[model samples]
Target: MCENNPVRFIDAFVDGLDLDALGFKRVKPKATGRPGYDPSDMLKLYIYGYLNRVRSSRRLEAETHRNLEVIWLMRQLKPDFKTIADFRKANRTAFREVFRSFVRLCRELDLYGRELLAVDGTRIKAVNNKDRNFTKASLKRDLARLDERLERYLKDMSEADTRDDDGPGGDASAKKLTEKIETMKARRERLAGYQKTLEETGEDQLSLTDPDARAMERNTRVGVGYNIQIAVDAKHKLIAEQQVHNKVSDLGLLTETADAARKTLGVETLDVVADKGYFVIEDVEACEAAGAIPFVPKPQRGSAASKGFFVKDRFRYDAKANHYTCPGGQELTQQGGKRVVRKGVHVIGYQNRRACKNCPLKASCTDAAFRKVTRYEREEVLDRMAERLADRPEILDARRETVEHPFGSIKQWMGQGAFLMKRLDNVRGEFSLTALAYNIRRAITLVGIPTLIDAARA
Candidate 1:
């Protein structure tokens, strides 16, 4: 007779896993005395789900019923849907801790070298559809609809009143009309209250499906999604930090992601590279202040430079006199200066058109009879940042290698567009798990599976 065969895929995977060493604890002692499943068994379920690309809790629950690996992992114990979902919901904080522990293990394994870090954000579709997004314009339209209904109801009431009363029926009709009017008024009030809340909050319309997520444009073809940002180390392509935001633009993400990378590495400073989308003058200044060297390409809007016309760069600045010299070597005197608000920030503008009209390059410079140029009062600071970026050409190449690797892997693994979770927090947790899983794969590949198993055992 053949020797009894018992070793299975799940058993092989869990052979060396030490749940306590990984910082996973059993549910509280007071929990209903249902024979508590081992935390390691649950961890095995998640790892199997991630490796097989089965991310849904419901799907994972089904896997326990049929999948051979899952059955072996759970020792033929099929958990109900509530048990699986509750585990994920209640263990969110603990799962985050587990994620950090894995990162520490990766560091111990030298998977991340803290040399070059790249930052980028990708939009993931929320459970909410675009039609659900309520903007000020949409709210106005809704209120107009309510107003029209109210007017029609009032007209009908007037028509009913004009008719001669024949009996008690007329009295009942009038009472019904009054009730209808009261109902309409209540609805109108509710709509008005919603409109006021929208206007005062200063946020774009919200998604009822996922309140924490806001619709954001990802690209020309993709719109209305959550922005998920990640910082990846150049060496071994391990994710250093990650965050989810409702912002459409990357302007505010650069400094925050760079600081996260720095904190993760426990280093004073690090080199951070990002694409043009992440470029913001204020963010650049913040990065410089934090001692992190940021390499972000400036976004070239369809201005003079992009249109082949003379750009501000062609004009030179005079530090001593605090004025700009036109391309034609004419002095642009400050005809007037005033502080003005733009994008919620106060900026000073200087203008001088008298010297521009008579200049030989006026045609290439501007269509106005006189060429007018205004600079941000803090333009000097931005200029210094540009100069710094100009000196580091290698940063652009490093950005390609550092940022794209993890994204390529993740996209290949997860497929394109949207996510498995419906809510923003759930999506975030899912993404965190994905990142943790990817880092684990990287760690295993870098230090060898045997070493990681040994560390996990320790």
Candidate 2:
């Protein structure tokens, strides 16, 4: 980065803050061993590196030797890659605190809009390769292939032995076959180990490269990575809160992210706008309970608009009479008290076979003799939320604008590939670094570096 550029603002900001006071863990002094690098210097080096778009620890170490700006930032002390890497690995909590510190600074500057929080999630690919990620099905297939290969080898050896072959070439072939068998057996054992691990941990899949990484989809492409949940403020389009999870979908993340943004901005009441994927009944209810008015577009699942069937949401739920008032003004009373749809979620089946028999809209509703509707006991909360959501189409637009911009900027900074770190904790710290760096860049762009420098000093 240029000496007089916004990079300077990062340096000034880091210089001004007492990292220890912000709960940044410091390396304890060793009485006898060689003196360790100062945590502040390492932090400054990382901040400077990330701000300048140089992310590799090796690159930072290289910068320490040759780059004038990095040398100045780290006070000419060139910490090796191990030291730098170890610092990041050991100080995960400290790195998170630094991200929050920058957020607090942003709040102090009144940069956060704070009111309209647009929540969304982006998939960040992990260092783990898709091929190295193993599922139960993959394990079974691999074992079958290994068994087939082993059987072929055994059959070939048996044929060779029956031919009474005793020449050097025959002996060599037999030896090679034996070696292949051993190798296959070892591989089979390794695969069995992976299978055992899967059974023991009860994980759907396991990534060999990065144990904590998971397989997820971004847009349409599926890969091993994390769902990086973020809540962006609509006013200035700044990220107010962030979380990284291994979950593949955003179904249950709405409330947690909105509430985190609420706490981060120190606001009692927050209005969160998110896409359809974030529309979960429990999450929506949680948001309202936490004083956040959520505007999430309901997900269209199994809605047969093309099939000419009215969607589930079109049917009005009457909480007072404990029945569903269908679009054709038919009352569907509960047939079952409660049925387990999935773990922790229960639903009651409502149906009116008599009403459907003579209804004119039955053709448009369903082809079955009776249309059955399932409702959760607490479905009224969602009905009320959807009623409020009906008039707030603009909130979804705001959500796209606010959240996508920061994701683009941050993705650019992270380079074409995903995280550089391996495991969850290290990746978290790495992401925290990226978040802080991006926020600093944004803060500098919003107000000039001069203003931020002044504020940091003040």
Residue-by-residue lDDT tens digits, candidate 1, 1-458: 11121223224445554556645556422347677667667766776677568877789989999987678668887766666666665545455555556666677667777877888988877777777666677778877987898798888888776776657688888788789889878867876776787778877676666666676666575456678899888887888888777777788798887787777677787778889997767787788678667777777564677667777777787878877787788877565555665664445544466666567887888776776666666666678767868998887888788778788787786553566556666666677777777777677567666667556555
Q: In model 1, which regions exceed 4 Å deviation?
A: 1-44, 65-68, 71-78, 137-197, 302-309, 333-346, 368-372
What lDDT is reached at residue 55 by model 2?
Answer: 83
Question: Taking the tens digit of each residue's C-alpha lDDT, what string does model 2 give over 1-458?
Answer: 55457657767888888877766655433333768777888888888877778888788889999987777677778777877777777787677778777787788899997889988888888999999998898899999999999999999999998998998698888899999999999999999999999999999898989998988877799899888888888878777877888878998898887897798789899898888898778888889899888887776676455566888877777778888899989888999579886667788999999999999988889988988888886777777777777777677777788887889999875462589888887887888888777788788779878778777777
In order, what lDDT does every prediction score?
A: 0.71, 0.82
TM-score of each: 0.76, 0.87
Name the candidate that leads on TM-score.
2
Model 1, residue 358: distance off in Å is 1.9
TM-score of 2: 0.87
